[model samples]
Target: MVLGGDFNTSRPELLAPIAQIARECDGRSYAPGDASQEVTHYTYVTAPGPAYGTYTSSKLDYLYSTDDFTGCDSWTQKADQADYRATTVPTGVSDHAPLYGYTCGGPRLSWDMHGSVDGVVADCSAYDNNGSTLGAVEWSAADGGAAVFGGTGHLATPTPPVDSRLSLSVTAWVKIAANAPTGAIAALDGSRISGFILWYEADGATWRFGMPVADADGWNVDRVIPTVPAVAGKWTHLVATYDAVSGQMALYADGALLGTAQHTSVWKAAGAFTVGRDLVNGRPNAFFHGSIRDVRLYDYPLAPAQAADPTL
Candidate 1:
């Protein structure tokens, strides 16, 4: 669930209700970085507009959610950093800069290493989200980071049987090791066919997001995002979505739109979903040799605005 608006979050009387609902629902605020009671809003400057005469800074807007579906841990306040804007002066967008968040964990699958023990990939979703270890994997690391394909590492689960007629969106945060250039982060494949895949290209610098429906001559649609200097050894968030109605596919990095294309074929792979690897030629190859975290899948295209936010 999500709740937001100009709640005058700075006021103790108003913050009371916000805190009450969030605590009761395990929710968190999107702005101000954390669940702390402190509020940060209202831009103050000696200019003309809303804050020209007030000469006070106050936080009047807020957003809260019960689900960690957006994959965003903290909100970056533009007002906090003086150098946030290099040369261009702040435009009068409003008294507030845009509050950003990413579109994450839909009604489908969601997983992370948050609550894992020794070497388990705990499914935090409310329904059939547990994954069976395929080959071997290691989880002895920091929070939300797990190593895959040491020798052979992967995770698999029975297909959730979501209706193919619906749209699709998949997102994952991964860090690829130098040794392992090309690897797959996730794929949905059947006995001999595949539905969709989120993997790194052979170049190891670009990520390939593809959906190959059974009826398509080739991949119904594919998007390659160039991420070289910014990808290696760094945790990069990748998001790909397909709009069934519009037949459009879009790919994003971090929270920025990279590119988009069109796809018209329907999905038909009623098989298993695999993470940390992809099935090639009926075999699990393209094994990911890095840390994977915050895997999410949605059954619908994310709103364009939400996709732009790093913490939705």
Candidate 2:
């Protein structure tokens, strides 16, 4: 269900097999970033026998998955602690340490704007320099009769009373208009206001999620669920959920699981929340350029069926 490698090239040839497996299993590939960004760099370091000469480095690890199996819940590249003078290691076997397991879990799902909106509050009475606006809109008649977000706009609201529970899922039925600028994100932030944030971005067509890293200062973390360009002007389902016990975060596109991350108790009770843009800076820089509907948030992480099930 899971495959990883260090493909030296950035073309499909290196990733085609992984993609095939995902397609056959009804799953998808989850890379940290797209090929265009060239996040996958190849390098290695050779220290001069404690003499401390120039060290070599390379990017050689990648994670892939089949459609039947949900992708990894979390992943990380290893670095030398001693090289950075952060810690001491007994053996200097290799410049790069082997990849290690950090966290694990299946994909999670929840509704963002489903059912009653009693406890939810929307703050859209403002506009930014990019002509982006935020406000709550009712779902259109064509969209399964759910009162979802309307217009090519973005908005942020506080987690309603119904979402006070610890572990929960969030789902949104979204449509990105044709030729919309990339770098758009739809996210949910923890109560810390600065600690942990879970978000998805349509980076020029590739979909990615931003997650937290352990023991790292600031919000240093990884991005998962890398893929080809997302079709413009089409309805797609995006879901993210966290299991407090397992400390896993999963991302689902449409009805298929894409990627997962591992973490423990990432979400705290901070009472801070946002959508459409990165809220850490308190601005709408990466604004979403599409229509969102059926935004639902739940108190518990939804099962795969609950997330992809149309009946819900």
Winning candidate number (lDDT) = 1
Residue 73, candidate 1: alpha-carbon lDDT = 29
Q: Tens digit of lDDT per residue, candidate 1, span 76-155?
A: 35444232225345434445534444444544777864534444556666666677776777664575455555637788
TM-score for candidate 2: 0.47
Q: Which regions of candidate 1 fall more than 4 Å away from where they truly are?
A: 1-105, 115-120, 213-221, 225-230, 309-312
- For model 1, what is the alpha-carbon lDDT of residue 100? 43
Task: Give candidate 2's whole-model lDDT.
Answer: 0.47
Clashing pairs for model 1 are 41-58, 41-59, 101-309, 101-310, 101-311, 101-312, 102-309, 102-310, 102-311, 102-312
Question: Which candidate number maximizes TM-score?
Answer: 1
**Residue 299 lDDT, candidate 1, scale 0-100:** 67
Candidate 1 to truth, TM: 0.60
